[model samples]
Target: MKRKQPLLLVIIAFFVLSNFIYNVPNIEAATKLDIKAKAAIIIDAKTGKVLYEDNADELLGVASMSKMLTEYLVLEAIHEGRISWDQKVTINEFVHKLSSPYLGLSNVGLTQGEAYTVKELYQAMAIHSANAATVALAEVIAGTEGNFVKLMNEKAAELELGDFHFVNSTGLNNSDMLDNHPEGTDINDENKMSARATAKLAYHLLNDFPEVLDTAKISRLKFRDGRTYNNFNWMLPELTFEYEGVDGLKTGSTNFAGYCFTATAVKSNQRFITVIMNTKSQIERFNETAKLLDYAFANFGEDTLFEKGFVPESKKTLPVTKGKDDSVKIATKDPLSLIIKNGEKDKYKAKLVLNKKKLNEDGQLTAPVKEGDVVGYLTYEYDGDDLGFITDKESTVKVDVVATESVEKANWFVLMMRGIGNFFASLWNGITTTVGGWF
Candidate 1:
């Protein structure tokens, strides 16, 4: 009997262990990326939600990526009528000298005396990353590369690029100083920006002037001189590395700033902007971008939680005090959405939170509630207490809850009638209860 008891105990322990193991939830781990770069960031283009990041705030030379801001300013100028696309710009000796192949800088081979339209120069800067063309366009807008750089810095500040500073319109290293430089030129000045800040700049660039994509997405284009210049961004189809949905953005490299790329890809109405900086080689930059894009598109997507003027079916009515209507319907003032990761939808939850201060002593809203009057907010949560599932990464969007119907104040006669009806109903309920107890 004693030996049998020990065996029985062992069996009981085994079953307990097995039950625990079987019931444990298998939660997938967060996605891990093996990115080989000094700094990197991936963000949703529209919402600016950061999906992935590593050392994204480390300041480093951005090289030709600075030209993106240059391109933005040029586009802004064009839109504001400061410059026209067809307006011809004369190339100065300084531009020609820097563009010379001997200078070891990227150029579209503009001659000192040659004239090109603003459109041609903009294309060269946007697609080919022609430093000379960038400088020429800057000179035309702000009078000098230094002045133009000032505008770039100002705009960067306006955009809240905390870690960005532009030393020159062209992202050329200050070490590459030319003889008899311009008066305001800083021989050692170079553009410095963090990957995070650069992503913000790229976001605004794409949003403000989408026309830049018309030039940026072009894999190749002919200069006014008929010389073909292929885009430096390898993510395009015309280049060796062909990433689907990758259209336009920018690429940068220098002795100081290793291969860097700010890439954007859109698939099924979802767009992502990824920035990789200080990578070892051009191939690695594009490859790392592909990894980031793949991870974003596969795992993360935008989900609209509520549409504009959407009211929750549950608890849609709030009690009204001394009003024509006993209750008022409420709903969200604007659409609410979230960039949820895969497998998180089931964990999503939303609750309508009313403004208690807006209520009277009776715990009901006061009369004269107008439609569209903000009464509270719709708060959303995901897996609030459940760690057994993968949930949103600690992000929430609150939508304004507003009254959907107007409730005018109750008139004196209406208030008297409601009081009399409430008194009679209470008296009848008490009398019925007393009589039933006697029975």
Candidate 2:
């Protein structure tokens, strides 16, 4: 009967252990985001958390902001040694036409016969929105805008920008084409960019070409031998509205796109990405963004939602019998984080529950146990509702469950003892083996 005490305790402990593990993560300490915009999303660039958002996946034309992608591709070429900053590019009619509403010029005063460095022309495209420079760089990279666009589409597909479709490197609506013109003749990518994707693209751009920001950060940049163009993104110099961290990206204001802006700000050791579309006025774009930025900086501070190797002990590390290895350590393949509401930091919580019996036996698990293999799953509950499985929320975070180690069975004596021992001994051995791991 004394032997029965521990065995009874094991059963009681099993049931009790789950009681604490499965309850909702604490939420009395979290904050909520207060945002009002046609479309908006605020994400923590470090952990890729979608801090706040609206219509993040909705298609929207980004206008000049499309240049963010262009900048990424150009910088990619430069990094790959495809072209140098000083390489001379011959001027053409397309380069000449850049003077029209492109380079902030009705027409840039480029002489019919002249050559410019790849660096100078690109600066005009990036800073001044020079159409000619866009075409020139496209030609240099792939010999034609059409080819470069093919490259653009390929990159889009690779980045999984499902809502993305690139018809021209310039992102202009080609009136010459379009069998069905009733789509309102929207220029550029036609569909508006969601607040989330803008954030994703901005994050990608910064990671890809920080140098672009170096130039975009410039309040006033000059080109074309004399004509100077000020950044249309007027938030740079504590400007008329005090856009302190306001840096470069692209701004669009076609009748259809209606003042699109993708803005990034860094303060308090945390960086934020915001996208606002179809604002009533250019100033509203700046004003709304400033409000968003201020809220993010003041109300939201950085939290380590995920560290490269932070696996809470709650993750499943099941014991195993004889096999190729000793034990199996499983964890969520992807790093997890929270994009909590503006004021709800303390309210954020996580709980891990292991699905023990469901895991296969034969003292074996299914093949393909990656380092981050998930033997079980964890649910992320915000405010006490089951969020189901946390797959890709915005399709940006990538992760897969991998097995940390292969499980080899215990020695013959241990297995024999496991079979003969009533229950407590088996339980004790399982715990020790699971905790101590393979010898």
Identify the leading candidate in terms of lDDT.
Answer: 1
lDDT tens per residue, model 2, 1-439: 9989999999999989888788757554333334445677666666566655656677776666777777788899999999989999888765555544533431245544588888887777776666567767888888877677778778866665556656666555544223311133333334345555667777778766777778776666677668777676777774465566667566666566677777776665567777888777888788877776776776656543544344546545555544445457765555665444455545645555554553565534543344555555444446633222111453333333446665544567876766677487878988999989865
**What TM-score fits each model?**
0.81, 0.68
Write out the backbone clash pairs for model 1: none
lDDT of 1 by residue, 260-370 (tens): 999999999898999999999988999999999999999889887777887877778889988999999888998888777877777777677878889877779989899
For residue 181, what is the lDDT in candidate 2? 17
lDDT of each: 0.85, 0.63
Q: Count the backbone clashes (under 3 Å) in each candidate.
A: 0, 31
